[model samples]
Target: MNDSLIFATEGFGLNLNLFETNILNLAVVVFGLYKFLPNFLGSMLERRRSAILQDLKDAEDRLEDAAISLNQAKKDLASAEQKAGKIRNDCKERAEAIRLESEKRTVEEMARIKQGAASDLNLEAARVSGQLRREAARLAIEKALSSLSNSLDDKAQDKFLRQSIKNIGDI
Candidate 1:
């Protein structure tokens, strides 16, 4: 039975029964491939083309967005730099103004102090002069009285006393 099953009725290539059936199967396969392969492969290729185009479009859009973002960042950086420069200039101007104001105030304060000192000095000089004048007058009066008492005799004293009495009566 195994031998019967394994044995071919006719030789390998020249058999009439199996050759016709194989030829029919080959024709059917060729016909099916010729009929279906173009449509299948065309649809598959179209789908792949669409996917690739979509990916390219997406990449282009992303690139455009990145360019726009980069431009915006550059603009922001420029604006920030301008603001920083303005701030630095403003700070420098403010510092200069403050320094000038401080110098002006310092000069004014020094003038005021000098004026006060000058006024004080004048007041002290006047006070000292007045005190010296009073001292000089007192000393002159005492010296005159001492000289007169020492130089006058008893007769001159009596005559001077009579002259003083006459002057007092006239007053």
Candidate 2:
């Protein structure tokens, strides 16, 4: 009976010592975590802040580039419009000049044809007048010969006819 009591008391003392050792180990681990936690958390927060700042700078650069491109596009559009206007004006002027030239040529051609027609009419009239003069002369000569033949006696006629023949031969 006395040996059993001593064994129980010895077991209780061992359990108390184990409990104290475990509590001390837990306090040491807590202190170590407290000492290192601030550095790890601060590094993580600074990395996140730097990444956000870089993204904002990139966005601003993109916006500026877009504005510059927009301005360049507007300038190109204005230049293209000016060139189109000039081309249209040149075409209109050329068309007008062509029309005027065509009109002038048509007028000149009409005048040339009229002058040619007038010259042809004058030549035809002169030819007709000359033909009429020749016909009248031949008729007058035939009538004069018939009248002279009827009026002259046979002996006078013979003498006049010989003299007329000699004059015709001389002519």
Candidate 3:
């Protein structure tokens, strides 16, 4: 039928005793926790927030430093590359100069060798001509000596000597 059995034991009993229900103690404990816990927890949370903000700022500063370092490194690399290029160009120019100097020296040496050869040839030719002239003079003198012995007797030699003396006196 109805729910009469549940309410048949007693009427609605409202217990207002503070010791039994512990409502006053609960209120005091909640009040103390509310007052003390906020001070401790709020200070801790503030410290954590400050630490996070400091970390963020430090990270940003580090990033800026890295950026500056990267820029400086780039400039240094460019400078090094330019120096290397200049050195390469200088080396090439020096090599070219050396080659030219070597060529000039080779040409000069060749010319000197040719001049020495020509001088030697001229000296040889002069020696041959002198020998030929001496040989011809000696042959002519021998032929004259043989003919003089055969054709010119004592009378002809005396006549030539007397005529040569007369011509010298007239001169």
Top TM-score model: 3
Backbone collision count in every prediction?
Answer: 0, 0, 0
TM per candidate comes to 0.63, 0.57, 0.72
- Cα distance off (Å), candidate 3, residue 171: 15
RMSD, each candidate, Å? 6.6, 8.7, 6.0
Worst 10 residues of 2 by lDDT: 1-10
Clashing pairs in 2: none
Pairs clashing within candidate 1:
none
Candidate 1 stretches with Cα past 4 Å from truth are 1-41, 145-171
Q: TM-score-based ranking, best first? A: 3, 1, 2
Q: Which ten residues in a row have the lowest lDDT in candidate 3?
A: 1-10
User: lDDT of all predictions, in order shown?
Assistant: 0.88, 0.85, 0.90
Candidate 3 lDDT over 24-125, as tens digits, reads 999999999999999999999999999999999999999999999999999999999999999999999999999999999999999999999999999999
Q: What TM-score quantifies how close candidate 3 is to the native fold?
A: 0.72
